[model samples]
Target: MTDVQPIVRLAARGDGVTADGRFAALAAIGDMVDFARDPPQVVPGPEHAPPPCRHFPVCGGCQLQHLTDTAYAEFAADRLRRVLPGLDPVIMAVALSPPRSRRRASLKALKRGNKLILGFHTEGTHKVVDVQQCEVIDARLFALLAPLRGLLSGVLADGQGAGVALTLTDTGIDLLLANVTADRLDRIEALLNFADAHDLARLSIEGPAGTETMVERRPPQLTMGGIAVTLPPAPFLQATPEGEAALVAAVLAGCEGAARVADLFCGLGTFALPLSRQAQVLAVDAAGPALAALNSAARMAGRRIDVQHRDLFRRPLTPAELAVLDAVVFDPPRAGAEAQARALAASVVPVVVAVSCNPNTFGRDAKILIEGGYRIEALWPVAQFRWSSHVELIARFVRPG
Candidate 1:
């Protein structure tokens, strides 16, 4: 008889593990794994769920689709606990974004003979899955897939490939095509006609030269706080609107009663604009276009936000410079804000809100703050990537008054 082991928990890469140090792909918690076979076989458990999308386990877009919502939330929270084992902070419940809420996605397109394969790449491979339907992206974005296929068929030569970046803004879909040429007059006219026909807010193409706006029926805009800011070509945005709201709420809660605040790495002022309503805000980022958009929006709305273009990674604000701020909110990229967190740790800032998409990096920064006499008051695990293994979080670290 083959010895069976019960799967205990999910690993960082969405693989199920057992107490005896066995791993099974697509296995859920409470599932039984039989190890007698060359490769272990997973028996469906109570926590197992039927993936809503038919492309599950094939498309690299999502990983934990086999997990029930409850189990998925638990997985997200468990990931956080694993990363920050020694830090006993109050971890709030996981905030999971609903299906079809993703506002942006990048897809691949390849023309093979008369057929055009367009979709996300398969896991661990560059082969495109040719998605017929997707449950992750917004319905509006998915609706453009068919139209894009038809358009690309005429533009792409056999064996040629291109990249498609789709973003849903307040006005409409903002589309950017990469590695595709539109030098010919007919191709340029087709692009313009396609933009007009589809009612695209903006359409741009990136070729050997650079990005050129083919058409801008309307400025692709996003309303942050109450200010409408023109979105630069493919600006960094939160995966889903719900996730952004949750992060913003957590940050605002942490920085409550703050008189002066600095929003570090504030891309297009998602949190800075809202934080400015009650406090004086200094928004800083490395991207000039994002800062320019934020500055324009702030000026037009009569909101006071001092926008500065500076790379935090290269030159993080020093402890002396941070002394004047009542609160500091920094949402760095996946690399996390190591240098900025160190500066905040050594500073006298009363409230510090650290927003991160990677738990491992956040854990390292949290320890640095703790070593600097700051206590983590609260931590919120946000599953913005939904069924994927990625997990985002917002933590509050404060120095005792």
Candidate 2:
């Protein structure tokens, strides 16, 4: 083990106690190569657990597993505060119970020996975790885990190995065989027989290179917080039902009412279409297929959405266009947008809202907006990715010019 003390410091807690001048056991969210540059500390009091994955630090699948849930949230909130020290976020209630959330997830898979192991990526690596059961799966899917493992083992005992993920529902589960293709349907047919015999309820299996809708029959769509959203095949939607609703509510509460709005890095119009009813919105994203689905959904919802498939990174919103925008919101991927953040900061829109999955990047970009004459109004944290310690956030920025 390398000595991480020099770079590590204790974090601050509002109601939490500090020991020996340290904020407990905190990990500095600094540069990977140079850990000494700027590190965020983890609180030491809470008991930290190694994630269920064996490939913990090596694979980099779960970054914050070592932190206790309390410590983890504190670190997340602290990261935001450090970036924009003026804005201290009010931490909301965390969905601590499993099976109560996570309606769907697009999981990776792998076959080991004679068993199919199903779990997320191991730490930072591509290797799949050899999991007996996931702690953070849908409640219904949680029950099907053992039998499905057995079914895979029995059906393909002596055959070639592969991995599969299940989409949970109130009725049953939908299984997706990631590596299997139509060419191997004869063999897949055999597995389906075994699943039927074993009674793996409503298991719909498919391959990566399949037809228009790989799901065959569409999966259960969710109405998260007054928003009628459909789960189209493999688009990136939140796993948990409650978690998704909470996130959308937070974003909506930020954008009370505004006109000539823009949502950058919008995915499936998660925040865009819903907010459209309140304002004239333009949703821009790079994924052509996802944007198409969003357009279809918008049409179905009887809502007007200006969908544009453009790379928000390479071609960011110019100040000229920003000059007309009254409000802005974005649900960017893990790698937050530095370029778009800059543009939003320079925009004439007095109110700017940013939604991000990664805290470190959000912290970095929030610091930029703060310096650009924007005062952060409210910072809200949401723990949608539970058990994994991944924190999501939405911050409302106001430019008083």
Candidate 3:
């Protein structure tokens, strides 16, 4: 009889591991793995779940869909615990976004002889999986797939590929097609007709020449902190509305009494706009369009937010500049905010709210802050990307007064 290994935990990349260091893909915690088999077979455990999507293990969009909600939450929390081992900050309950809540997605499109395949690429491959049904994205967004297939069939050349970016804005769906030509009058007309028929908020196409806005029935917009801000084409947005709300709530709670705040990398004022309500916020970012949108929204709403267009990577705020602020909130990209974190560590700011999508970088940055006499007060793990390996978190750090 082969001795079965019980999967104890999940690795950073969503692979399950046994107590003795064996790894199994798609194996959930508490699952039993038979290592004797050519490819270890995983016996479903209490934590294992039937993946809701048919494309599981194939579609690169999701990885841990085989994990039950309880197991998924544990996976997210475990990621933080593994990354920030010694810090032992208060890890709040995981905030898991429900299915069919994703507001944005980037899909691949390919013209295969008489048919158009439109969906995410297969795991670690460029091959597009003609998605018949998707469980993660908004149903409204998924509903457009059929029409999009019909529309692109006429636009794309044989054996050609294109990129499709779909975003659910406040007004309606914002569509951007890349690497496709629409210079001809008929092709352009087809695109315009599709946008008008589907009531697209905005539509744009990108080719070797550049991006061109073919149609703008209505300006694409997104409401941040109760303020309506027109969005730039395919602007950065939190994956889901529920996830955005959770991050905002955590950041707000962390900087509860701050009178003056600096929102670093404040794209489209996700945190800055809300922070502006209670504090004088100085919002800074490198993206000009995001800053412009944020500035326009702030001015129209009569909010006290100073928007500055500066690349934090090249020139992070000096400690002296950050010293005046009571609290600082920085939400950088996946690379994390190493340079900015160093400056914040050296600053005399009382409170620092760090929002990160990568745990390893966040842990490194947290260590820098701790080394500078700052202690983490709380950390909230958010499963914004749902079943994917991606985990986002908002942590509060305080310098002992």
Q: Report the number of backbone clashes for model 2.
A: 23
lDDT of each: 0.93, 0.62, 0.93
Candidate 1 lDDT, 178-271, residue by residue in tens: 9889979888988999999999999999988888899999999988888899998888899999999999899889899999999999999989
Full ranking by lDDT: 3, 1, 2
Which whole-number lDDT from 0 to 100 does residue 20 have in model 1? 79
TM-score, per-candidate, Cα-based = 0.98, 0.75, 0.99
The digit string of per-residue lDDT tens for model 2 on 1-401 reads 23233323324322122232333222432211222334543323334544654454444334555556665565655645565555665555543324336766555544567667655676446776655554556656666666666655544544445555565543345565544544466656766664565444344444454523233343434453244555444447766666666677777887887777888888777778778878878889998766777777787777767888899889888878878877888778888889988877776778888888777788888887888888887777776666444667788888887
Model 1 C-alpha RMSD to native:
0.9
Candidate 1 runs further than 4 Å off: none
lDDT per residue (tens digit) for residues 83-103 in model 3: 887768899999999999999
Q: Which stretches of candidate 2 lie above 4 Å from their native place?
A: 1-75, 85-100, 106-108, 120-129, 150-163, 169-174, 191-215, 224-227
- Count of backbone clashes for each model? 0, 23, 0
What TM-score does structure 1 among the candidates reach? 0.98
